[model samples]
Target: MRLKRNPTARYPETGEKRTVSDEKKRGGAFALAQRLGRSLMLPIATLPAAGLAMWHTARLSRRRTTGALMISVALTAFLTGITEPLEYAFAYEAFPLYAVHAILTGTSLALVNALGIKDGFAFSAGGIDYLINLGKSAELSGGYLAGPVLLAGIGLAYGVVYYLLFRFLIVLLGFKTPGRDEDESDLDTFEFAAAAAVAADRSKQKVVHSHRRA
Candidate 1:
């Protein structure tokens, strides 16, 4: 009679007895999916906010260029919720534009606070505080009138300051603010591809090692 052997004892690569575990592989897939989801959500959520900002900026336009820039900044802020990017965009033209934007943002916030206007939804750091405070104070002040007045004040301040200061800053300084961010760099898709390839190679090596040990 021939001797019989256990079939499960042999590994696929090394032909030795060992067990295989898929847990790590599954975990990696889950992590990757989560990261991708978050990345996509970030840009998606801000687009609406930026779009609304653009509309508001356009409405306040006395001329063309400054209005366009404000709209762009609003869009950028809404989309990324980051003012630095928008600030840096204007840094090259008229150093005073930076000061102008800062003053306008502060003045708008103050007027919003003083008049008690509430923002329906906040998309960026720029105006979110003013709206929130306005909402809270509106609630505390008994009714609708106080909030509307404050909101009007905010609108007025934003329009006037943005118009006057932007014009002055552009005319005088001719752009170029300090600490401004430079234009965005290229995406470099190759780096991501290389990283992925390296990870795949590592995983393959791991799988091979495990089999050999088995």
Candidate 2:
């Protein structure tokens, strides 16, 4: 009684029934995004997050609040390889950036491979995993540490690239990233109101204490 043009599947977002064929037909950037799946981003462990944070600072020199928050996130990623926070920040909202990120990730993998760099196996690719893979008994400097060092070196370069590209694209196209959106402004206004209320309360308490003293 029923037929399918393509394999019937639930949409990744809404759980509605659809076909890959139908998605492909829609075409353009969204299709490409769906094809891309998730970013295979590396050093989300450090550089990428740091790049994003630096971009925020680059725009507003005195505003270091976003920078500090991102640095804390970078530390989490660097130590444990928890990258979701940074990845989700722009992935859904900006397809072009996401595409660039995926390409950069692929390039990093290829470079490491072309250099005959041995990808280490462990719980993750973070600093903790890097150190753990080096073996707890190993010395500070040795042949065993070579691969990780190279990987980290490459990561540093990638981070610089990320910072430049992200800064340029975000500014040029006005793509919202972190502290660049209205949502942040709204939140800032709410915080100001809350702080003002607290200050007024404190002032009232001081006045009451003075009257009591009188």
lDDT by residue for model 1 (139-173), tens: 53345565534444445444554555554544454
For each candidate in the order shown, give its overall lDDT on alpha carbons.
0.37, 0.51
Q: Per-candidate TM vs. native? A: 0.36, 0.57
Flag regions of model 1 displaced more than 4 Å.
1-72, 76-81, 106-137, 176-214
* Winning candidate number (lDDT): 2
Error of 2 at 137 (Å): 13
Model 2 over residues 173-200: C-alpha lDDT tens digits?
7876655655566465345335434543
Instruction: Give the total clashing residue pairs for model 2.
Output: 0
Once model 2 is optimally superposed onto the true structure by TM-score, how far is the C-alpha of residue 156 displaced, in angstroms? 1.2
What C-alpha lDDT, on a 0 to 100 scale, does residue 161 get in candidate 1?
A: 44
The deviation in Å at residue 141 for candidate 1 is 4.0
